[model samples]
Every structure is written in structure tokens, then in C-alpha cells.
Target: MLFRHFYNRLPLQLLSIRKHFLTNKQNYTVIKNTQTYHNYNIIPDVFDEAPNEPLIIQFKNGIEVDYGNILQPKDVLEPPIIQWEHDAKKYYTLCMLDVDLPTRLEPILRSFQLWFVGNILGQNYMETGETYANYIGIGPPKNTGYHRYVIFVCEQKNKIDYSPLIKGDLMLPRYRNHFNYKEFSKQYNLGIPIAGNFFLAQYDETVPKVYKKLNNLSLFVTPLK
Candidate 1:
């Protein structure tokens, strides 16, 4: 009964035990809070698996076409010699879209068919495919912001007819704005693009007159916008 007598004579270490437990509890709460903050700031790598192929387009002037590069309408009035490494197994159709330069009068952005030549052996554009729509010179209104002109080279599933569009009278006002390049490609049996590029162009005084003349062509046909 000596141990029982010592227990009754001594105060138990309950306060010391409670203090140790509380310290550990606070440390654990701090660690959990820090871990949650760390997780919130972490960003996962999502685009690591994406394709890194480059689509290159250059002008005769030796200047490479890039997005946001300032250029004039006359500079590209004549089509640029477009180049892209093809998948030797299949021939592709070359489609170009001149995404319109927005004007104060018409703030809604639109795109027009600059060139929609299809069918070709290799890259011999002059030798093949129906030249459905001819290239139209850029004519953004004076003071309008730069226009984005995009060129898309798409894959052809089969030979497609562009006769209905080509044979019709080409008018600017009718076909100028709101041309859906992607839809047109789909309608013609052309699938996703093999390659693409774009450049920018701003407006000048002659733009209005040029657009008017384009609209007033004698062989004008009511465009299916």
C-alpha cells in the first residue's frame, strides 16, 4: 500500500498531459491549413501532349506572314505563293479567308472568301482544282482597325464542285462580309485544316472606292451570304 499512499500524496500530471496534447493539436491544424493553400496555387500541365507542328507562310517580298504584321491591301492584291509540307499520301485543297476589318459603321466582324481553289497534284496551284472564287484585294474602310486575313490549307476527302459559286457573278457587298470559312470547307467535303496562317491589314482612303467598284461589277450576282 506504499504506491497507493504516494499517489494520494502527489498531484497527478493531467495539466502537463493536456498542455502537450493541445500543442500537438494546434500544430496539426497549422499543417492542414498550409497544405490546402499549397494545393490551391498549383497548376497542372495540360498542353504538354499537344502537337507542336509549325505552319509557315511567306510573301514574295521575303517577308514572312505572321499574325499582327501590318500590311497594305495592294501588297497582297496578287496571291502569295503559299507553301506547306504535305503528307505525301494525299492531295489537299487550299482555302483562304480574309477576315474583315471592322468599321465604325459595321462593328460586327466578318470574313470573306479570298480564294477557295481546290484539287491539285502536290502544290501546283496554277495547274489544278476549280478556282471557285478569285482573290479579292483587301479594302478596309478608312480609320478602321487592321483586318485579319487567314489562309487555311485543308484536306480533301474527295473531288468537290465549286462551280455554283464560281460561275455566279462575284459581288463584294453580297459576298464581302459574314462568310463562314469553316462551314464552306465542311460543305465541300473538306475536313480539318492541314495548315493555316494569317496577317493583318489596315484601311486607307482608296478603300471606299475600291469596295464600291468591287460591288458594282457588271457581272454581279446576288451572293448567298
Candidate 2:
């Protein structure tokens, strides 16, 4: 009876030991699996549907501009215009401008330009030029009569501080005293390029040639006075 009792206790002890060993192994395996999963499964290689282009918004009055493509004073110029500015106080800044494109087309145009500039030109406007009187002309399809008025907001690769002065040459020297080229270059090199751009196109309403083809069509029918 004593031998049988001892034998039974021995088996129980061995079973307990085996249970403890298996539990510890399972815990270790769980820890190892967690680490492996975090290292291999959770890390992302690229952003998921991240913005491939800048954000563009248009305001009422047919003016289109983007805000994401802002250029600091150190971008490249070979790629062309990066940002835009307009003199009309009503639509001067991004905050002030109101969207004018067709409801369905507004978002499309904005996104298209944002992606187009971001991928192709690699730059965008950082700040709006402060010259209130600046204006540029846009001719017809071939520079014909009654040209269109275009306001351009060009982005420069260098930082400019146009304070106190109202109007001057659009060259860097005009604002050289206010800019820090060394610091500007450091920031410029790190810049992702202009992230916003805009343009305002206004046409003459009274020009007869504006709708000459339409007028010819009307000649074939009864014209509305």
C-alpha cells in the first residue's frame, strides 16, 4: 500500500512538471509571434491613398488657385510657375477667394491641377506677391483684338521680404536686404516644391469677334435682338 501511494504521488508530480513546462513554452511562443507580427505586418512601406498632389480651391469669378503648393525662397525656377496671386481685394488671398467653377467640375479641376503640378512642375506658390497694381495681359487664341486680362501669381525659388516698398522690379535684389540667402537655401533644399498655384482669366464682353461663329449661326436663323 505504501509503495502504491508513493508511485501514485510520483506520477502526479511528473504530470505537474510537464504542465508547467508546456505553459512556459506556449508563453514564449506567444511573445515571439507578437514581435514578429509587429515587425513584419504593421510597418507600412508607403502611405495608403496619401495625397499624391496638392490641394486646389477656386473662388467665385472664375479664379482658380491652390494652397498646398506654397514655395519658400529656395525652390527651382526651371520648372515654371509654382504659386499664384491676384490684385483684386475680393479674391486676393486663398482665404478670400471663392470657388466659381461648376459644382461638378470644381473638385475635378482642383484635383487635376494639384496632381498635374505636383508631378510635372514640382513647385507651388508659397506666398502671394504684395504688389497691388501688378497686372498682365492675355491675348486671344492668337493675340487678336480685345485681349483677355490675366493676373499671374508667380513663385520664386528664393525667399523675399517685400516690406515698406509698394512697387519695384520683380528681381531678387529689390528685396535682397530683407532676405537671408544662407538660411533660405537651407529651408529651400528641404522644401517639397511649390504645393499651390492659381490664375485669373477675364475676357472682354463687348468684343464682336468674341462670338463671331455664333453670330454667323444666328444669321441663318432669326436673331434675338
Candidate 3:
């Protein structure tokens, strides 16, 4: 029973490496924010270029996020306060994309929409904007390497048309993958992300509860591979 409990807590990478020594402090490490976005390929993967500035993200627990830092899924279960500077006259949109859904190296499910808010003005005016997709916190499966939760704050020239853009009920996981950086930019000319930042997360003991609470729906469109 104890072993099974411990197994659930161990991330996929640790288990794959055969690190059974839970007592060894050396096995635990933190990804420092000092690392550049290139280290994680955020430049080409999520954005054409580096972010104009770092995004200010904090959870209900008072832990603030910095670029490339690692966090636990349970710690960020709620929609975080996303802050950025922009001209009040211009509308903006914020998107959180989980590039590594099922795995880090080969994301068969390339991008999973974590959150999306459109038509926001300066000062994090989310209420005025459309809540395209209500936030769903990170819940990477128990055996995927660390997943990157990338936030891209794009400058919107105008309000988005919901018609052809949004499909099925976004509240459901299947439809939430409705938007992506490439599509939005091509269609609306939203322009490159003005500001962005991301933090990494991995499967943890809290993930099981998250799945149950959310109807056990994952990035899988249906019973996929």
C-alpha cells in the first residue's frame, strides 16, 4: 500500500530513471528562472520571438510565478491573476497553452487550451472581456515529463467574433481546444504576443482528484491513443 502511494507521487521522469530513493534529497531539484526561454525552446515553440516582458502570474496561495519556474498542479488549480501593461485604449487577449499535454518530447496532442480571455483592456480587465474558456488548471497525467504552461498576452485590434471561431461548449474539455496562437494570429491579425511567460508543472498526487472533479476528461478528443 505504501509503495503504491509513493508511486503515484513520483513523476514520470523520476520513475523512468529508476530513482527509487525517495529519501535522497539529491533527487529533488528546482528549475531556476534565470534560465533563458531558449533553454526550453519557448522562442520557436510558443512564440516567434521572446516575450516583450515577463507575465505576472500568481495563484490563490500567494505563490507568484516567474519565467520557467516549476510548480505543482494542485498549487495552481484556480485561474490565476494575469497582469500585464498595455494601452487602455487597445483591447488584448490572454491565452494559456499547455504545449506538452500527454508528453513533453512528442505531444501527439500538440496544444491543449488551458485558459482564454479575449477583449481585455489594460490592467487585467478580465470582466469586460469574453471568458472564451474558463480556466482549467494543470492536470498532466501521472507519467508525463514536466509540462509547460505558456501564457501569451496578445494585443487585439478589435473584439473577436464568436461565430466561426468558437465551436462546441467550451466548458467541456473537447471544445476547449478551440483556439491556438497560430490560428488566431492568421485569422484576426492579432499580431505576435506582446508579452508572455510560462511555468512548468508535472503530474503529482493531486492530479487524480483534479481528474475526478473535472469529469475525467483529458486532452483526448475521444478515446484516443
Candidate 4:
């Protein structure tokens, strides 16, 4: 004679098993199914860890851009540096060091460059204008490594018409020969480059949108441990 044992609810038993597996953090392993596996102790948690201060960007030209002031959440305004100390104190917990480039910070720097370039062109709508979409390359080219971050405070020869295509907007093949670097130097009347540079900035993972909007400016906060 054959005998069998049955459970009242097999599905419910399996559901509870899955729930327990998910909820029990200590029982999980990287190689649970392996016959031989190694388990290591997890690192202890740390809170409010301070990152290396004064994040530095070393340009290919050997210049560095340092954010002159520490970054805070309040620095999101038109003149972010006005209440620097107070905001830093209040939001120190939220602040993190600005470190290497991340995908999130790319857009912020692009936006900043768009505005800076637009300001050169005497237009405020550069953000929404086709200028940003047309002119800017997404990131530096391969094998070029990291490009130098240079700030140009230039005065144009004529008030650039926002409607016409910008000089930088032309395709590399077509306009590469016509950039007129000499004319740019003559029109703008630039002096010898400054000796050193710095900018103070902060970043927070919680505020991703701020990074997206201001990525062009190269503002970012490094993630904490």
C-alpha cells in the first residue's frame, strides 16, 4: 500500500516561504546554491561621513577649477553664495564632496555652458532655444581624455543675433576650417590667462533634478560612504 501526506494549502505555504526568504536579510548569500561558498562579515554602517573637501578638477591644460565656496542646498538660487555660511551650517548633513564626473552631472554642466554661451550671445532663452540642442557636444571625445575646463568672459564683435546659427553650432567637417580663431582673439581682446581658479560646490543624490538642470556648470556633490 502507498501512503501520501498532503498539506491543506500548498500555494500559501510557498508564498510564506518566499516572503520569509525576502525578509530574512541574514540568511541570504551571494552564492546560496553553490556546494562550497564563502561568507564574509558585512561592513558596519557609518553616518554623516565627511568626504574629502575642496573637490578639484585637473584640466588637460594643467589648470584646476575649484569651487570657491562650500556647496549647500540653498545655493540653487540666482545668487547662491549670498548666505553661504548659514546654509552650509543648516544643510551640512545633506552636503557631500564633488568628485569625478557622473552621468547625472553632465546635464548640469551643459545647461550652465548653454547659459554662459547664450549670455555671450545676449540671449536668455538659450536653454529652450535650439542653440543648446544644435551646438553642444554631449561630452568630451574618446582618446582626447578629459578636456580642459576653461572659462571665457568674452565680448562679442557684434551683438550676436540669437536667431542665426552660432559659430560653434556648425558641423565639425563644414566649419572646422572657418572657426577664425585669430578673429576671436582680435574681437574679444583677451589678456593672458589667469594664474589659478577655484569654485566651491556640493552634491546630493536625493536632488537629482538640480544636477540635471545645472550639469553644464560642472556642479556636483560626491556620494558619501
Query: TM-score for model 3?
Result: 0.76
Q: Give me the overall lDDT of model 4.
A: 0.27
Q: Write the per-residue lDDT of candidate 2 for residues 1-225, one digit (tens) a residue.
A: 998887677877797987898879846644553343233211111111112233344433333343222221112112233232222232211111112111112211111100110011122223433432221111122112221111122223433443433345322112211222223325434222112222323223332232242332113222112
Q: How close is candidate 4 to the true structure, as a TM-score?
A: 0.26
Superposition TM-score, candidate 2 onto the true structure: 0.20
lDDT tens per residue, model 1, 79-168? 677777675546677766555435423435455566767776567777765676666656665555666666767667766666666534
Find the number of clashing residue pairs for candidate 2. 25
Which prediction has more favorable lDDT, 1 or 3? 3
Q: CA lDDT, every prediction?
A: 0.56, 0.26, 0.72, 0.27
| Tens-digit lDDT track of model 3 for 1-225 | 999999899989888667555554322311222146778877566666566566788898787787878999989988888787788888888888888766777676667787777888675655687777777787787667788889878888777774664777765666655345676687888777877788899888887665665567654522224
Clash count (model 4, backbone only): 16
Model 4 residue runs over 4 Å out of place are 1-67, 79-100, 103-114, 117-152, 162-198, 211-225
TM per candidate: 0.62, 0.20, 0.76, 0.26
Weakest lDDT window of 10 consecutive positions for candidate 3: 25-34
lDDT of 4 by residue, 70-166 (tens): 3332332221111111111111101111111232224222212311232222222223222322222122222222222222222233333433434
Better of 1 and 3 by TM-score: 3
Cα displacement (angstroms), candidate 1, residue 152, comes to 1.1
> Which structure is stronger by TM-score: 3 or 4?
3
RMSD of candidates 1 onward, in order: 19.6, 22.2, 14.8, 22.1
Stretches > 4 Å off in candidate 2: 1-52, 61-160, 163-192, 198-203, 206-225
Mark the 10 consecutive residues where model 1 has the least summed lDDT.
Answer: 42-51
